[model samples]
Target: MTEVRGRMWVRGEPADGFTFSAISDCLTSEDTLVWADIYDPDHDTLTALAEELKLNMWAVEDATAPNERTKATVYRTHTFFTVYAIQMLTAVGDSTSTLVKHRISAFVLPRGLITVRLPPVAGDDPGFGMDEVSQRFDELGGQQYGVGALVHGLLDVVVDGHFDAVQDLDDGIESLEDELFDEDGPKRGLQRRTFRYRKDLVELRRVVLPMREVVSAIKSRRLDAKTSPELNPLYDDLYDHVLRASEWTESLRDMVTTVFETNLSLQDARLNTVMKKLTGWAAIIAVPTAITGFYGQNVEYPGLNTVAGFVVSSALIVLLVAVLYVMFRKRDWL
Candidate 1:
C-alpha cells in the first residue's frame, strides 16, 4: 500500500491536519514549510505527486529507478537525491552478520521537502521512520530554518544509522581477530565470516562514499542563499559525520583485509611446525631400524647369535634413540 504522511510548520510552529493534497496550497505561503513522506510509492502515486509539485520528470524517474546509485542532482526547480539507510545484523552462533540497505530519495524544493522510500517495508523501524524524522524536525525547530532544516534532520538520521552499521561491523571484525590465533585451527566459519564482512563493507562503502557529494550539493545548491544562517552549522556538522562514516568504512575494509592475510599466515606457521615434529620423530625411529638391520647381517663379525650381541645391539639402539629424543625435545621439534 502507498502511504503518504504530511506535516507543515507555519512561522516556526507546527500545524495539524496536513495531508498530501494540501501541499500545493501550503507552498504558496512564504512562512510555511511542508514535508511529506511517501512509503513504497507506486508509479501512479509518484506521478500524481510529481504533477502536483511540478517536479522534473527526470528526477521522478530517477527516484523510481531500481538500484539507483546514491547521488544528488540539481535541476532548475528542485534538487533531487537518494540515500540509503543501513543496518547491520551482527553474527549469531554459526551465522555471519548481514548488512541491510534501504533506499530513501528526496526532492528539495524552494519551500518544502518531499521524501520517498522504496521498500521491503520495515514496520516502525526507526531507521525509516517518518515520525522519527518529524520528531527530529520538531526538536531542531526545523520550520524556522526552512527546507534545509528538514533536509538536515533526515540526513542526520541516515548518517547516524551508517555510524551504527560501521560500529557493528567493527565489533564483528574484533571477534574474528580473536579467532584467528586459535592453537587448534581457525574456526571453519572464519573464512566465510571474513568474506561476508568484506562484501558488506564494499556495499556500505558504495553507499557511504557518495554521501559526501550528496551533502555538499545540498549545501551549495539548496541551502547557501535560501536557508537560515543557523542551519549552515548544522549542515557542516552533518557533513563532518558523513566524512567520518566514510573514513571509518575505509578503515574497516583495511582491517578485514588484515584478518584474511593473518589467517593464511597462521595456517602456514602451524603447518611448518607439524612438519618439523614429524621429521624429528622419523629421525628418532630410524636409529633402531639401522641398528637392528646391522644385526640381521648373515655373516658373523663377533659374538653373532650370542646373548651378548643382542644385549649390546639393544643397548645401543635405546641409547641412540634416547639421545635423539632429548635433542629434538630441547629444540622443540617433537
Candidate 2:
C-alpha cells in the first residue's frame, strides 16, 4: 500500500498517485512538499523507487532485510534511517509477550520523505499509526512547515510508546517485588513473572539502545546537504528522547537483575529453614529409636522381663528428647 500526503510544488496542491513517476513528476513540475509512505512494497516497486531516487543498492537491500539493527546512514543527496517500533501484547500465561516489531525505514530528502513499513500480522495493531499524528499536523497547518514537522510528529508518537512500555515494566517489577517479600502469602507465580519481565527488558533494550546513535547522527548534521536545516532541531529533540529511553531501559534491566537475585536469596533462605526444622525433628526422634532398639533384643536382657524396666526405659527416652528440644529452642536453632 502507498499513501501520498501534501500538495504539488508547481500547483501548490495535494498530489494523487504515490508512485515513483508521479512523485518525480511532482518534484520536477513544482516545489511540492509530499510524503510517500509504502507498506511492504514489492520488489519491483522497491527497485523502481531506488532507480528513480538513485538510492544505494546496499541501503535498499538492507531496508528489505528483517531485524536489521536500528541506525542511520548518509549517502549522496539522501539519508536513510531505520528504527524499530515496539508494542506490548497481552500477558500470556506467566509472560507478557510483545507483538512482532515494525521495521520502519525512512529516506529523508529536502523536498519529500519516503517511508517503508512492514505490515503487521492479522489482528495486530501496527506500531506506527499516523491517524492521530496526521490530524495534529493538519491542525497546526503542517503544509507550511513541510515534511520536517511530519517526521517530528511520527517520532513523538514512537517516543510516547517507549515511555508507556517502560512504565509498564516498572509496574511489573514492583508487583514482583511485593510478592517476593510477602511473608504470609505464597509467591503467586513471581518467579515466572520476573523471568518474563527480564526477557521483555532485554528485547526492548535491543531495539531502543541503537536508536540513540541513529538520532544523534541526525542531530549532528551528518546527513547530506539535501536535508533541511529546520529538521535539525527536530532530530535533536528526538535524540534527547532516545537517550532518555535508553537510560530507562538500562535501569529496568538492572531492576530485573536485582529481582532475580532477590528471588534466589529468598528461596535459599526458605530451603535452609526447612532443612533446619527437619534436622531438629530427626534429632528428637533418634533417642526413642536407640532406646527401643536396645529393649527389643531377644538375648537375655534385664529389661525384657520387668514392667519397671520398660517404664524406666520409656521415661528415659522421653526425658532425653525433651532435654534436647529445650536446648535447641534455647539456642534459637529451631
Q: Clashes per prediction?
A: 0, 6
lDDT scores of the candidates, listed in order: 0.86, 0.73
* Candidate 1 ranges beyond 4 A from true positions: 92-97, 121-127, 182-185, 223-227, 294-301
Question: Which pairs of residues collide in model 2?
Answer: 7-13, 7-14, 8-13, 9-31, 9-32, 10-30
Backbone clashes, candidate 1: 0
List residue ranges in candidate 2 displaced over 4 A: 1-21, 29-31, 121-128, 139-143, 184-189, 222-235, 301-303
Best by TM-score: 1
- lDDT tens digits by residue: candidate 2, 1-334: 6443433322334545555567766555435766667777787778887888778878888888876888889777777889877776677678656534667888876566777777665555645665655565555454445556556666667676777788888888888878877877446677778888888888888888887777676555443224446656666777788889899999989988998998899889888888888888899999999889888887887767899998999899989999999988886668
Which tens-of-lDDT digit does each residue in 1-334 have in candidate 1?
7888888888878888697888888888998888988887889878987998899988899888888999999988889999998876545644454777889999998888899987654454434566777788878875787888889999998999999999998998998998887666677888888888898899999999999999999888864355488787888999999999999999999999999999889888889999999999999989999988887888878768789988898999999999999999999998
lDDT of 2 at 97: 62
Top lDDT prediction, candidate number:
1
Query: What's the true lDDT of residue 255 in model 1?
Result: 100
Per-candidate TM equals 0.92, 0.85
